[model samples]
Target: MSGRFAELHLDQVQRAFGDTVALKGMDLTIKGGEFVALLGPSGCGKSTALNCLAGLLPLTGGRITLDGKRIDDLPPEKRGFGMVFQNYALFPHMSVRRNIGFGLSMRRTGKAELNRRVDEAVRLVQLEEHQHKFPAQLSGGQQQRVAIARAIVLEPPLVLMDEPLSNLDAALRLEMRTEIRRLHQSLGLTTVYVTHDQEEALALADRLVVLRLGEVQQVGSPEEVYAHPVNRYVAGFMGYRNMIPVTVGSQEGEHATVHTEAGVKLVGVKREELGSEAVAAVRPEDFAVVTEIGANTIEAVVEIVEYHGREQAVEARLRDGTQLHVRTNSRLAPGDTITLKVPAERVLVFA
Candidate 1:
């Protein structure tokens, strides 16, 4: 699909259902061949925005254009877009070959062209041996592969996926994420993937559009969104573990200096004076267990320990009754005392 990519613009697109507004004045621009992921918790309107983009849900206001032509008015079939749903949506009675060829049949393509495309899609999905098998006969991952093959077989300029891996097992989901990213990179097709799984979105998307309560919270590359979340809500969603409540003492340049509840003074992620009190968002991985305790060091009693393959999760409580989560490689017992070194540069302060 090289040179066939189309720039898509969603300008102030709004969708509402009477009392509940799903997407309110949403605007986004997708560059050609770029992969974008809409990420948020359930009921946050990420799926609603995606359904609107696919023409399954009509926008209550604003417009959608692709390559300078309005497309929100067009029906889904006429829009020439591919959709992959979470349930796979494969026909139980249809064989793998028949399911993948269903779109071409709807268009009444020539028999020769249909067979050629179906064969190519089957091979592309590594389902050559199961081409004659029915959906019931295949595994969940295999069925998902068929669904992906069906969507890409039509060679649409854009692809819309709504949590396509949610139904799979953990291992299968990990496997499919890599395959999907590879497929997207190879095709160079502009893909808009909707997923609530933060890890999945972080792994597969070139850019992320984070949504909350029918509004966009942030839009940027995964690293940008992960490193510099604008608010506490976005920070918590991005896996910030330490939310230290602090009072803003002063502001200068890009950061604001604040006083932590532990009577420690340090620079946090404060962008502006958020009243008198603000919360600092800190990643667990950023906290280091140090041998010496001094200024900016918090002493805590370890409550429990959870081991991850690459790192260890330590739960500790401060003397002032604040719970803290710290990630490190050291092994700690339940009654052990540990000191955490908090770096100001790695902290984000929010109102």
Candidate 2:
């Protein structure tokens, strides 16, 4: 699918169900061979956007173009895109081989071509040993592999995956994540994936489109979006567990010094236009237990501690009842006092 599906553009895309809108004016351009993930919480319209792109859902407004040709008006089969659903929507009675070749059979492809594609897809997914087994005989991961093989065997220019790994266990999900990335790279397929899992999105996508309440919040490369989120909502999704309300004491070019309600002063990199009121966003991993702290320090009492193998996840509370989560190597118990320090560069300030 190299140059066949070069570019896809979603221009002012909108989807609504009567009075309720699921997606609104979502604009995105995906180049060939790029992996883009639509990320947001439930009811955020990521799935709605994917359905719109796949022609499973009709557009209430705007248009979708593939290689400069409009396709929003086309039906699902007419658009010729492959979709792997979350439930691994395979026929229970069909064997792995039949499941993978279902699309070709429906298209009335030649027997010789169909067999060749099915065999290649089985090998591609490493499911050759189980080709004769039914879906009930296969594991969830294997069933998912069959679903993926079925989609790719058609050699669709674009692939749409709606949380394909959500049904698997953690270990299986991790393994399948690598497999999907390998398939995308080897086949050079343009992929649009939808997931609410930030870690999965960060691991699989070349770029991320973060949505909230049917609207796009931010779009950028994984590193850019992970390191620098545009707002508190995006920051929270990107692992910023602490959003401390503060009053800006001073503002420099791109940095600000703000005082928390507990009288803790923090210096953070500012990315938005701010007034006196602002929020300091910090990830749990960015906070460190320090003995000496002259700046960017918060003193709190530990409330709960969770052992996470490599490090301890501690929940602490400030004098004003604000809760802060900290990830540190030091062992601590409830009611213990600790000083947490955050580097200015690791902090993000938003209005």
Candidate 3:
């Protein structure tokens, strides 16, 4: 892929509807041919950002650029970008081949060329077996595959998908996620995907931009965002279940002693400058049930134990009344006394 077509730049983009702000000074730069995901909860303006890039929605402020050229004023049709929606907007009456050929037909391509492209698209999505079937004859996953084939058949440089797997069942969603990743790697098309699903973001994105309330929270690779979250919001969003209020008792060397309200002294490393009071977040998997009490150990009463097949999630309340969750293979009954030892390196402190 050419370097020029692989670059995407969003410069302080903002969008508003009357008095309600949907996006606020958002800035991002996506590499050409990279798969990037915009991840956030509902009403967080992720869809608005994708719309702005596609020229389907006009920005209330800021600019959008592709390959260093401003394209915010361009119309959606003229943007030369393919979009796949959650609904798999296929024409019910059209066959798979016809649906994939629709874009080429609209462009007045020769019949021979259209046929070749349509066949190629069908093969690309492995829908050749159902090429003659209409949308009604196909399963949900097959219909979505056809939708994706239609989007890519145009050979657009960029593809935008808005929760394309939302309609599928859990098993099918997992299958489609791998398929999309494979397709991205094979096609080398620059992609911007939007989803509220954290697992989807982690699985599909080369990097992710996490948004909250119309503002950019953090932008990083999955490992970076998950391992070193910037704040409490990002930490909680990344599945850190234990977030307890702590008073910054002392700072020594690289470790900080945080005193929880329940009088438990938890040791953690501070990545940011947190003053006298802060919040400490610990991942469930980071805590281990131990018989001995150590520096970062907390004595708690087991409130509940949930068996999730692969692992057991133990919910316990510390002496300070703070709820802590631990994931272990060792089974524990409810109301059992336990000492949960949190590794200092696994504990994250946020202001």
Q: Each candidate's TM vs. the true structure?
A: 0.96, 0.98, 0.96
Overall local distance difference test of candidate 3: 0.89
Give candidate 1's total backbone clashes. 2
Residues 1-351 of candidate 3: C-alpha lDDT, one tens digit per residue: 112284678899999999999999999998888899999999999999999988899999999888788889989888878889889999988988888998889888999999998988899889978999999999999999999999888878789999999999999999999999999999887889999998899989999899999999999999999888888888888998899899999888778889988778889988678899899899899888899988898888989999999899888888778888889877899999988888898888888
* Worst 10 contiguous positions by lDDT, candidate 1: 1-10
Best by TM-score: 2
State the lDDT at 297 in candidate 3.
88
* Lowest lDDT 10-residue stretch of candidate 2: 1-10
Per-residue lDDT of candidate 1, residues 1-351 (tens digit): 213645789999999999899888999999988999999999999999988988999899999998898999988888878889989899999999999999999989999999999999999999999999999999999999999999989988888999999999999999999999999988887899999988899999999999999999999999998888888888898999778787888887767888877766767656444888898788888889999987557788999899898789989987767788999988788889998888877878898
Report the CA-based lDDT of candidate 2 relative to the real structure. 0.93
lDDT score at residue 121, model 2, on the 0-100 scale: 98
Ranking by TM-score: 2, 3, 1
